[model samples]
Target chain A: MTDGQETIKSSIWFEEAEADNPYAAASCYCSGYDVYGDLLGKVSWVQYLYLLFKLDLPDPQHARLLETLAVALANPGIRDHSVRAAMNAGVAGSTKASALMAAVAVGAGNLGGGREVYLCLDLWHHLGSDMEKWQHAISQPSQDERIDVWLPMEHFPGFDPNGVTCPRPVVQTLALLADIGSYQPLIWLRDHRSELEAATGYPLSMAGVAAAAFHALGFSSEQAEMLYLLLRLPGAAAHALEQEQHGWRQYPFFGTALKPMADADYQSLMKTTEAK
Target chain B: MMESTRNSLAYFDNHWPTNKGAWFPGEAVRYREMSLFDDFRDKSWMDLLIYGIRGTMPQPEVSRLMEQIWIICTSYPDPRLWNNRVAALAGTTRSTGALALGVATAVSEASIYGRRPDIIGCEFLISTCDQVAAGGELDVIVMEYLKKHRSIPGFGRPIISRDERIEPLLAVARELELDRGDHLALVKRIEDVLDRKRMRMKANISSYCAALLADLGFSPREFYNTVLLSFTGGIMPCYLDAVEKPEGVFFPLSCSKIQYQGAGIRRLENVKK
Candidate 1:
């Protein structure tokens, strides 16, 4: 065994103390700031989220950028896979937490998902503002051999592999975000949006925009991934709860085409299988 | 109302072209080009589930083996299990049936335990068999696999090094006369090689099931999807039991349970005021 390495998990942002009663917290400080005494009700939630994750306060412009991104991510709609997974559980009368878990499971993927944002930020880190690098990288994402890392980029992280054209909402979002702040990544993206789309033949999706926005916010790839998952939960939660209210009868259901084998067919198949 | 085909502009399109049937609410519905209501109305859910995965129903004996395997294995209702804890917690908190079981089953796709290890183990055995067929030494191949993957999935569980489920699973397989597959024998030999190497890795329940299922001609992906509901039986009871209890009373660890081992009590400055 190795010495000097601490075994247990510990908090980074918070230094919490118990009240006279063990069940209650007496003093809670976040990143040297007194959370209850000085910070409560003073900063907006967007600013607080930035502080909690980044361990530093955000300027107004950065906060606005983050807030816009948060609102953009708040709901992916019922058609989205993550929200649909939650809705599937919710309609069947699953718990709110269960719906969220389902959402997280489906959303934590590489294609138009939170994990895509993670890999997108990573790609951004490697291939900053170079078009040639972007072209080469998109075609062949750097082979990440780490077992723990997600499967190699499933259609260039941010772009929608299944999309026909750059979505109207995605274009408007890029324009809005570009107008709201001076994040270099977003500026570059806005300027070369058409060129990139033309090169890849894949439309820019919300996930791609989110990856850029989060990268502009100075969040790490891992942190951006987590934020993507968290931000998208609001939509999953709302749709799941709504679907629960609507019940399974109204919710979309795809029936599988079942092909039952006759006894003779089964016997022949078994004989063939046994021969193998 | 917005729609488009894959990488092409179109008003409306279906992504899944091979989707053969659908439910049309009031009118007649088709499944596998057959009427859903008219035919196969009284068939067991097992038929539907198995057919949905493989696109064809297996022999009755295979179905019976699967049914018994499902019964004997993974029926643990103990709430202490990590997956079952989710179910039990949901139950205690009065969550709906779908939510508790759904989340619990979702979590059962744990890398170290449950469905993932089962799929991973099956893949490993298949790959290992291929390597052996090409004349690679057993121990050398096993060593190489371990070096890349770190730990062998479906072997040596985290808690209790000795698995309690393996014996019962074997007993059922023996009764069904499905115990003598080549993959099963190979896996046991691999366990022996591991033991000889001074590694405490034993073939756990997932490893055993993986070998059996591999012999049954299930692909790794198919096996992965098939075991999604494996832990539902165990999780359901935990959820149901917890639901019967009072609100928010499951475990309820106090603030003192937390050991605040971080930089404590700092001043409030530089808050962007």
Candidate 2:
């Protein structure tokens, strides 16, 4: 089997095996239990139960654990919290939760963050214009068609961390990662940048970040895409949850309320924070 | 001697008659008149307090209430309830400044309905991106115009009597019995302002649509996001239509020719010693 397919299959198998044989109770025996059964059809609940039993883990508990892990892994803030919790849990001998936390931390920090960083470096390596050359070109005062206007800017050519441009944190992180010689995610970055820019009318910083993160994590382009999709799931969920929790419906006074200006005191407070 | 009529006409045209004629006898006498005008300057604070109290209570409370509603809607396991909640949120009323809140609620609704293990695979991603980009651009442009012109654009237009889009959504809210009365009051106030201005500017549909989403329980940030999401559906078809137009280019420019009346001197003449 291909490395990716093997990885996916093995991961699935491992999860099932772990669930069925929690505490290694049934390591020796247990067959006809597959987590990913019926390649083209619906997977049955019986199969799920069998897979859980084979793993030797309590069925409902394992399912709950997986769901929690999934949620934690998807959100960066939650993942960060999970990492701390995992470390504590490991110390406290909470093996199952610790193991889950470790897996999530690795997935989020090393795999996800690393790939994003690599992608940014790759783009910079390939498409970055030399500062001196850019300055010389700009100074020549010729209306050259080839001159890229953004080339001379202090930051990298296309990544804007602030939401004013794309507002995706991944892109900014990738740019920073590339500066430090992470992996090369630029191949995908260069290819997709123009398309993303045209599509969004904003720079493709997030995509670059995603590519870098994927590359660092040793994900192929296709795998990287899958990982990105996976990572974004929790964020979307969290946003939804927040919305639900807040019970915020549509603004009743929309179009009637004058736009608010930040109070001077608030502005001063912001300045104080910035200074600090 | 009598002057030629043509010559007199030419003189009259050229001179355009200066103020050489005599004024009427009473023209120089200036008359001063005084009229009583009520100045609300003393009661301004009271007026403001009353206005503020009336306007402030419903929206903030409604927005907070909607946030809870959004949670319940999304968290409910029933798909039918989820869809209904989403529709309800989309059809709710919101505070005037609750754009961000409204978008958050709508996006959450959309997210709940379109939930999968992965968000990148969601069909709404591109739509979300497009909407955000377009809305962001519009906001920037509007802000820039406000800076330049000292007024907000797209908020009030004279030609539109009432925002047509708001009524249906409000009707839905009434049907759903989610009407907080504050939204209605706010709408009326907006109308009053428009009438007073007499400039014909009326609230655009986006404002009410955004407000409705907000009233359903979206955060202000999410309200903006929802606007972007909603516009994405509209933008894709519009962009496609633009691309598929009969003309090869989406946009064409017409060049204008100007006639120059000048001396026919081809070269500069230099005086030498």
Candidate 3:
């Protein structure tokens, strides 16, 4: 028993010291999980996976990895089978990750969650350009001429170039993270800003704040992705809890039910109310 | 019939217009009487009886019978006091202006409520902003107002604008052909006014949309209500975003003069000694 304990302790100590253990990296990633959890909850797991790969894990344990994957899948209410397929495909590196991410994006519908993620990326893309110059370009006398130049400053008025959430805590976090020498997340933010912005109308600064906080706390891409799932899970949990507590079973066909009204019913209600 | 009466009572409770002494005594009396009937029909007789009997009734004899039979059902949480407070708080000239806009626009635009005109307008404005921001030369006047601390009307810090969804409604107006030309004219006129004033006060999307709804023959009241509904979509998301990403923690008391003055007094005493 003593020998077994000693061996286990040595293995644990060795893994901690190795700096390349994926599980250790993941644990490190989890520490800063709260940063973008809220925003990420609104995004697709596939995008989260993309970010995870960017975090550069060493050798992640199978169980820990699966737990992270399960959290992401279950949080969004994605079917278990689909999640398993995606996980398998993701491991195989068959661009199935992108397909899964796209599925999550489609599921988001027009609720503006996925779009917000894209907006964050867009804002991050133009962090270093002069704000005044961008403003000037957008406000130039020749409106037609100004349209040709896709300057970030001109495009996003009253937004900070470097500050996440524009003059908020995200900038501070980014500085702190940069000071600690974790440059990969910030670099990704800078590179993906445009595409994300075009996809989501929200500013990059908003998303960057969360990304910066996670990066500062040493979260790998996978952990960051998981953090987003965790953040969004609370909202869904709250809704579900509320539904359960209230015994609020939705009956769509019943006009008096607490469910959302159909267009015709809504119109009739409005008409009746107006007449009154 | 009873349900209609109840609904009418609820509606009155939610949206009873305040008395500004604009009507004659007879008119006021008639309005109050009408309200009583509406309330009586809406609430159950038992509910009314219980409320009337509460001992705090202003006049004992009058209150006794009133308390036993009359119940006032208010849409507000607390009818007697809260409704008055809300009314008092809402008694601003700006609210009157909003009322006036609603009335005038309603007379002009009759079809504002068809198929969620406000939502349609919002979608258009969003699409336009995207197109213009991408490469099209769509005139964005609010971008200028953001410069001067005075907001660009519909684009920033919403509460002051109240009817921020007007621009999108105007986009809807373009489709309905109710008052599209007039709506566009209003937008152009606002631009002209801003240019003349040199203050950069461009007409925001809200005003434009409101004008369009007016053109579509929606009553100003309906137009305002639709605008509120449309803007609620933006407001809800923004609130969620704000909650998820709080800007900063503000310490109101810490920054108060009491703390500073208290410290200064100690410093002064030390200097005297």
Candidate 4:
């Protein structure tokens, strides 16, 4: 109000050291329920996560959906780079939490975790209710237009380079669900399946569904990546525990690859061992 | 992106030919015409475990089991199943977490035969029929499993009255000349008793896998670990299915379809209006 500059005020947070000893309230909350006193323990972890991120709980079906997807994401094997990183750390004698952190850290990268999912979600947000825009953008474009306009890159974010094709089972499942539930984003994606496949040389990926799912589940773009880490946590921990039990030794990469030298060099190398 | 690619290419080019060893063309990695049994026989069981689970090379049986798991998983991806529903809701291509949960939950239950939670140890299979190991009665193990867990690990499935996998997997085992294991006989006995009880619960793929793992000389814990890893092969395709699509494009459903029973639309009346 003074000199055209307005004073700012906020009420989302407060520091309370009152005589009555009242606890401070948060705009968001926890402890077996959300800020609105919804019972948290009654819901699945996926439901709880949705509540935390969006400050609202999804329906039971959606919650179940989230839970299902979360379960699918959990893999304790070595195929995942994130799990391998955790295993490496565990073998090196790091604590369980520390090893899990290592896994989560690797998951933050493009290859191991949810970065691709987030990127896909971001693109969707940018398009917003404009299916034509996405269609035009993703379709084959002229070389000049590609260089000039903000057209899509040669590689659409989530599509794989190993040649793209949607798995038959996923497509069939999605088609079945599409009959029961109607959503514009999914309809658009489903309708354009063949076109997208032909253009990109890859089928629609699970990340596409994930991006749509995240958006539908009311998660922000950033939460997509975080969710990846969160879901992978237990699997990583399992790997870490397993690695701790498996045989381990400290050695540089390819320590055994180097060729042994002739008599003089070998003798010199063994002198320390001989002395010991 | 271009810069990163260029940098990577430059680094690779710089590091090219660090060694002066002669190049040798090896056998083609793909076993297009080779027999699964023959390929499996080339490697030891330890190598199979290391390669199939923790390492890259996949064993034939492991691949077959994983495929079976994947088929069963993909069959009912409706909202009724927690794993499938979650994947559909999340818009994930692979149902990654759901698959993990499925495998983990499945493997975790391998120790149960009747309600007693018996470990599927080697002795259980190789020992005398009279010996009641791990508190599991040989003749009454099925009943015990029913009494304890109200369900068996390798028997009974949701959404289906019968598990179709039992017959085919059993047939495969027979053809492979692996059907003679004592564990297989015990599974049959359990199935027969369940049949008599009118439960009609046939031994599932997990039960057969348990028999196979036991026959292969894996410990109970190792059996659990291998089972956990074996089924993972199927989930990858599902994940790939989802990841390949454009962002925000899979199984799209609206918020209205989600049933809300919690706190209704209410204004914060106490806040200064």
Off by over 4 Å in 3: A1-119, A126-208, A211-235, A242-276, B1-212, B216-273
Cα lDDT tens digits, model 4, B88-108, are 333354434544344323432
**Where does model 2 exceed 4 Å of error?**
A1-82, A85-222, A225-276, B1-76, B79-209, B213-273
**Top lDDT hit:** 1
- Residue A51 of model 2 has an lDDT of 38
Here, model 2's chain A TM-score works out at 0.32
As a whole number from 0 to 100, the lDDT of residue B210 in candidate 3 is 42
Candidate 3: interface RMSD equals 28.0
Clashing pairs in 1: A94-B99, A95-B99, B91-B242, B91-B243, B92-B242
Which stretch of 10 consecutive residues in model 1 chain A shows the poorest summed lDDT?
A254-263
Best by DockQ: 1
Q: Would you estimate the TM-scores of all the predictions?
A: 0.80, 0.25, 0.23, 0.39
Model 2, position A124: C-alpha lDDT score: 41
Report RMSD (Å) for each prediction in the order shown.
Answer: 7.2, 29.5, 27.9, 25.6
Tens-digit lDDT track of model 4 for A1-276: 134233222222112123443232332233223344434335556665775665555666566557756665676356466888888877877756567767866765443357767767787788764756666766733242111111224467555433335766447635543443455666666777677666655666555555665665567789886786688678888877877877376422332232322233333333333343
| Best TM-score among the predictions, by candidate number | 1
The models' CA-based lDDT, in order, is 0.76, 0.35, 0.34, 0.52
